[model samples]
Target: MIRALNLEDLGSWLLKANGMTSDIAEVAARREPVRRFCVRPGYRARLMAAGQPVLLWVSGDRRRVTPGIWAAGELTGPALVADGKLRVPLELRWLDDDRRVHRDTVRSDGRLADLEVLRQPQAANPSFVTAEQMAALRAYLPDGCGWTPALSPRG
Candidate 1:
């Protein structure tokens, strides 16, 4: 049932994956339970349906952060928002094994270098990525890796 997800419709977004420990990024890349919680309010509707694709960029330790794409996959189910926080159930296809990308290589590209979002990633939450940014990211992906944008249901 999960395999039915259309890759064409999945939207790409950037996430600041730094945590108190390396285990957070490790477990998430392996498609394990990564429960997120927040005690404050100001919740946004992160509408995630079953089979939706998501590109999860994981950053290692704060001391030495890698600058590259990490993992990609479809949402196994809907994202649950309880209390004052959100929990996303993800099914990720691990990208880089060690989970770090070359910062200089990506920055060399004039197109990507201009992107403030990519230049300085927010350490707080996930943000929607533009098509142009996704294109830049795809260019840096490893040879065998594939990232086809999901088609909108409306069209």
Candidate 2:
């Protein structure tokens, strides 16, 4: 069973999906619960660990999909070096259509305006999300949206 996430302790990250090899929208529509995400070698890859919360940001302008936070979940295991990159195991649940946080919404929010994903749109995967930004993002997620707050953001 999935446990409530302690955002404060687990922290949060933004995983970017450009929908090049695999269309993020298609992946989100899948019934699969778990996905193996690979990130290029870097410091951020080294910082990832099990249980940390992550938001899947679907980048790029797809034909019918809006680029934004499409899914949320926690890392299932620490990053593993494989094939010269890091593989992060996670179980993602796609947010409801009405619950998916849009990119424009985040860009408009003053608290989230400076999000790394916004500043470095072309940056590699695994962007950092500040505590303040996470708190702001949480406001868009309603109860039963798959994320259960287990601790205060400042905790």
Best by TM-score: 2
Q: Could you tell me how far off, in angstroms, the CA of residue 103 lies in candidate 1 after the best superposition?
A: 3.1
Which residue pairs does candidate 2 place in steric collision?
A: none
lDDT of 1 by residue, 1-155 (tens): 11122324334544445544456555644657433322112232244445544565545553655545566655555556665456556655556555344556656777667443454565344444445656766776655444455544321
Off by over 4 Å in 2: 1-10, 144-155
Which digits, one per residue and each the tens of the lDDT, describe model 2 over residues 1-87? 122223454347678887555666676777456467887666567667766678888876556677788888877776787677778
lDDT of each: 0.50, 0.71
Error of 1 at 127 (Å): 1.6
- Give me the runs in candidate 1 sitting further than 4 Å from their true place: 1-11, 19-22, 25-44, 60-65, 82-84, 98-100, 114-116, 143-147, 153-155
* TM-score to native of every candidate shown: 0.60, 0.80
Residue 118 of model 1, lDDT score = 59
Give candidate 1's total backbone clashes.
5
Displacement of residue 101 (Cα, Å) in model 2 is 0.4
Q: Residue 54 in candidate 1 has what lDDT? A: 52
